[model samples]
Target chain A: MNLSKKSKVFIYILLTAAAIYFLAPFAYMFFSTFKSEAEAIAYPPKFFPSQWHPENFIKAWTSQPFGTYLWNSILVTVLTTAGQVISCSLVAYGFARYEFKGKNILFMILLSTMMIPWDVTMIPQYMEFNLFGWINTLKPLIVPAWFGSAYYIFLMRQFLMGVPKDFEEAARIDGANAFQIYWKIFMPILKPSLILVGVLNMITVWNDYLGPLIFLQDRSKYTLALGLASFKGVHSTQIVPMLCITVVMIIPPIIIFIIAQKYIVEGTSGSIK
Target chain B: MNRKKFFRTATPYFFILPWVIGFLVFTIGPLIFSLIMSFFDWPLTADPKFIGLGNYIEMFTEDDQFRKSLVISLKYAAIFVPLNMIIALFLAMLITQPVRGVKVYRTIFYIPAVISGVAVSIIWGWILNSDYGILNYLLSLLGIEGPRWLVDPAWALMAVILASAFGVGTMMLIFYTDIKNISIDIYEAASLDGASVSKQFFSITLPMITPTILFNLITSIISSFQQVTLVMLLTGGGPLNSTYFYGLYTYNNAFKHHKMGYASANAWVMFIIILLLTALVFRSSSAWVFYETEAKNSGAKKKRKGGKEA
Candidate 1:
């Protein structure tokens, strides 16, 4: 619909107001990270920090065994991402390129699992982990991710299915084994999708609080999310550093989000079929 | 054994081996274990004594928290799903037009979607702070008294719900893309037919976007029921147990209360509700969801193509 000049001005104003309304919390949280506790809890809720104390972040970071938790989180995310990308690629290739027995039924089962919440399995899964004596370890958090997650597998499978059959046909004519064709031919073409999934998994694992909350029993074994959660619990009323820690926790994901979002929308959106 | 055939067959299994094991051990294994555990008097410390339907009976009859959680969860799902889908769709429609600096608005809308639930809960907790919060400051300006948000039993869950509605970024992004996909020619055609902008939106846009609406509704229902973290953080089920949601309750039973068998039963009941609800949505899609391609399809592949487009 066309609009008059006044209408356009009004639209612009409304949008700017909405932007600030939605974005104010982020700014508030960031500024709160720099203020003293008294100022943070002061009346009228100051829009800016009274002091520019970047050291609040350092205090928050050093407040916990955040270093170890950060390490654990990095390790877990890397392993899970590597596992999912490699394993899902192989499985997706199988679904896409090769035909086999019980394939459709298995795929349907895989898709159906997507709707199932992790809570349903909490008790039994906990029981099993208890049996394995893997409590407080990173094993439960990371190991299962190596298995092809159903959604990632489906996404990769869709991409693989789009690859031209002629490439494989030509590879066979050149005496290249299926392994060689999959590795040399399909894997490279699947790089962007793989990177996207891997990065997605990293963000997911990084942001996950429940997994660590459930599995890890000790403070030293915590991830960034779990550690920050505990830190928040301990220092809830302490305004500045807690907010600083909160900001620290999300910065990586936010930064990664800005970078990876371009690939996610375009790369995935392009493959409509 | 030829290497080519061996590689083809073996490689897929290798790729899926992790999932297969996880599915059996983690997914399917726990599923069966949970079922079995539901019938037993299990504690974390020792072997569960077989108690045959006792846990299930206790959940519905004796355990007040279990029943309360079920009600709260259902209420939460009922409210959360509609708000998320409606608000997100509205945001999508507003910013979907070909306007300058739309990307900035889109990015502003999308940022909160990617904000982790943990971060959001903490941020909202601070924002909803009773005395010094920005919310209260805004309310005081309007000469309205702001209730103590998280502390008050009556408003605690409602507060959490409102907090979530502010950041319906994921659904907003999904709907934005969905709206963008609608051909501009449809709008042109409707305009030529003397349809106003609102009329075209209701007729052309709403009907076209139902599939996404339906998808969001079902997914949000499932997620709302599963939203444990916010409650776990904000109220920890609260001062008077008014805001105790099902997920937090379930986690409490399994972890804190040492009622593994009981928790399993609760989870199973929740699963049944979700399954039945989702099945109902899929079941009724034919009646209300206007599948343009499905109306014309004489073959299955065309329908598959159509499904992927939405």
Candidate 2:
């Protein structure tokens, strides 16, 4: 494509302006973390702090049991990511490779389930969890992912459908059973899709506020998101600490997104395409 | 033959058993149970009592908050869907242009989407503060006083909408991908015919990407109706209940107030509405959404690809 020099400059300026628009809020929050509480809320809202305070991160961490919150978040994120990958892979493999009665109907049903609003099932699931003595623990958040969500199942199925059948047939000729072929051949080949699923799940589980808010009432069991939200409600006036903790809370997902961004962007396009 | 067929089918079921069991126990069972529970006066601590249509009748007739919440959410969807679609399409087009550091800008835009829910709400809470906020301060520079964003009832919904719109990154990326897939030859042909860039965009690009537009529209609509976490964290449906979204109402009813039956009834109504809306979108899409491969009804492209492989 050819562009006039004037048009090229225009495109660059427009893009730079958009970049700032999208990034300004996060950048402001980052700078506010270094400001004193009063300065953070001072009139004419300072974009840069007069005096930098790096200790706010430490102060915020000690203000609550953020250590426990971090642990809970890591536990739920790791377990759910693993569970979703394994379960969704198994299910996707079943659908991708096999020709069986009711296959089309089952796949259609799985797709339809993605449209069911989470609110519709929240009441009964809460009741069911309460009955099983699962509320207030990480069980409610962790256990469900082991069953495979509809969206992840759909994504994995789309990926696996494009994999050629020759490898599975060759493995079968070598006396490999269905599970063996899945374990050895397909699992290795599905690494990119698995990473896609893992990164997506990690971001979601790491940043989930509502699931932890409803199920885990105890602060000791609170995920980072829930803990930070509780902090916001209680310490509404403490801007520095709140902003500092907000920065800490968002670091993991941002880092993960940056590292695995190619898989996320390209894989999403591939799925929809 | 019967035994052989049983084994053939049973193997796949064995692999899929976890999901099957999960679907039954988790999704289907709860869906039915919630439906049944909606017809009762079920409390958390007390035994459930049968009251057929009672909760529904009360929600429709007596519950003013219920009606308000529904309208508020619908209003939110009304603003959010169109705004999101336009912004997403614009950004997608912007990034797809062959400019310097485009990938970096794409990542920057998507960063907000990855850091969602509580963190986003808290960030926006500070920005939308009436007196001390950067936004209001910026407004003052132009000699225009800004309204109290999250605090004022009149602007709270708009504040929430602005906050949520930051996540248009995902939609933008999807559109970007679809737009990138358009064959360059068509644009070249349009250029030969002396078509302007804007003209080519509307006449060629927009028509081709209509299928993706439809996909994003339905998904955004469904998710917009199901929005809760942001509202709960940002405003908590406060300032005269201006931002009392339907999802938050259902949550508060079941969890805060412990009116399980009534909440279930609220949820059921929401579910039906979503289904109807989705069906409506799908019904309307046939008129606009064009499938290039199917609508063309030619295998010329398919044959070319086949020739390459052979």
Candidate 3:
């Protein structure tokens, strides 16, 4: 795979161009957040504000109940991630380690569930949640993950299946019950995959808009994504504050992605193969 | 049955109970109920009345928006699926090259994907603003006029496409990983045979990555059809209903317009279309998608047949 200097230069040029395409919008938005409303939208748009107004972030935060929204986002993300990791692992371990009757059928059903578009079941889900009086609460968003999702379960099952059968036999011979072996032995071994599931779930729940948009009504119940979107609806002309909130909303997920880049890559490749 | 034997038999189900319960409560029950609701004339406030096939019939025969939204979604998928895949695969190949500081470039590309659709739409909105947008300003400096990206019906869909394509890095990473895992020896051997780099890519890398291509294709099709958030936030179905995506149409019907039964019908239509598309692609995949297991199995059969002949 050795390359000539010319080819290397060409590659760098192409890479730099693509990087700009991906990054230029964020860079523009980040800098524009500091600009005054008029300056931000001035013709021949400025790339850097003449006067850095870090106060825009503060203004945006207080303009809405963004602190409340941030807390709700964190609550949903943390709970869902914890729930998905634990529940998916248990379900995946069952499918991977046990030879129960109807296991193949049940597992097939789980896989097929991934293909069912949320649009189909969402109306009835809304109705059901309403009947339970769970609408306008975080329960609709957070409670379901406790039962496990098909994708995470499948992912965990893939990781677990790669473990040798003999890995668990030694523990069983020592009279460790199935639950004990799962909690004591497999949980530790599945740490990376658990982290993978947690990270994936965190990013999704943190940034989800439609789930909150549908079930929750009050601004108090709004997650960061829902809150940011609502902000846009209210103040369409206020670009600076909107951009500020957008920047604030994106920070946590970007930070999480940067920290967990390795697991994310490995998890994606794992799921495919 | 004895207690011990009963417990042993139930162990697996106990372990998997959470998902089974969830499937019944959250997935299957709602699925069945939504199907039933599709058959009725249910509204948000009023009591439901049985009107079997009424909603479906109205959708096909009467609802122009229904047809328009469907066409819009199809047109989007047609343009987007292939374009995004190419960009993703191309970027993937670029990043996988043996170059310095490629990691930084990869992170830069993927950072946009990690950002929420909400933020992405806002950023693009400001950048594509007709008067004050940075993009239009930049184009003006080049002695050109940028179309009102979000306003003009002619360009609204394209604007949506441009904004959505920012997240192509996820698919790029998928292709990158697949390409990275390929044995370097294959390319080296191809080089020994005097195959050009392009020739090696076509004969080796391309064929080797078909499985990943198929995976990306199917997933992207599913996702592109479900592309509600970007359009919902970015265009709000726009100046001329030009960008009223089917997902948005269905969401509006159910949540905004409060036609629960009609929306349920809309959703079922989308589901069937997706199922058919998936089935068609899967059937066609045998012609192009090269599976490692299939290759190995055929090789094994050949060796066995040769042994028998000997």
Judging by TM-score against the true structure, name the best candidate: 3
lDDT of 3 by residue, A167-254 (tens): 9899989999999999999999898899888988898898899999999999899999999999999999889999998888888889
How many clashing residue pairs appear in each of the predictions shown?
2, 0, 0
Cα error, residue B232 of model 1, in Å, equals 0.3
Q: Docking category for candidate 2? A: high
The residue pairs in collision within model 3 are none
The predicted structure with the larger lDDT, 1 or 2, is: 2
- Evaluate model 1: give its lDDT: 0.82
Look at candidate 2 and tell me the lDDT of residue B45: 87
Collision pairs in model 2: none
For residues B1-310, what per-residue lDDT tens digits would candidate 2 score against the true structure? 9996777679888777778988998899999999999999999889999999999999999999989999999999999999999999999998988777899989998899999588889888889899788998888999999999988999999999999998989899899999999999999999999999999999999999999999999999999999999999889998889999999999999999999999999999999999999899999988998888775655777788899999
Residue-wise C-alpha lDDT for candidate 1, range A28-116, written one tens digit per residue: 88888788788889999988977877777788788778889889988998898888888788878878887776778878988889888
Model 1 agreement with the true structure over B1-310: per-residue lDDT tens digits? 5986777667656655666777898788889888888898888888889999998888888888888888888888888888778888878877876668887787787777666678888888888989788898988999999999988888898888987887787788777777888888999888889998789889999999788778778878888889888788877888688878898898898899888888888888889989999999989987788776876665677779889998
Tens-digit per-residue lDDT, B18-68, candidate 3: 999999999999999999999989999999999999999999999999999
What ranges in model 2 sit over 4 Å off?
Answer: B1-6, B298-310
lDDT of 2 at B296: 61
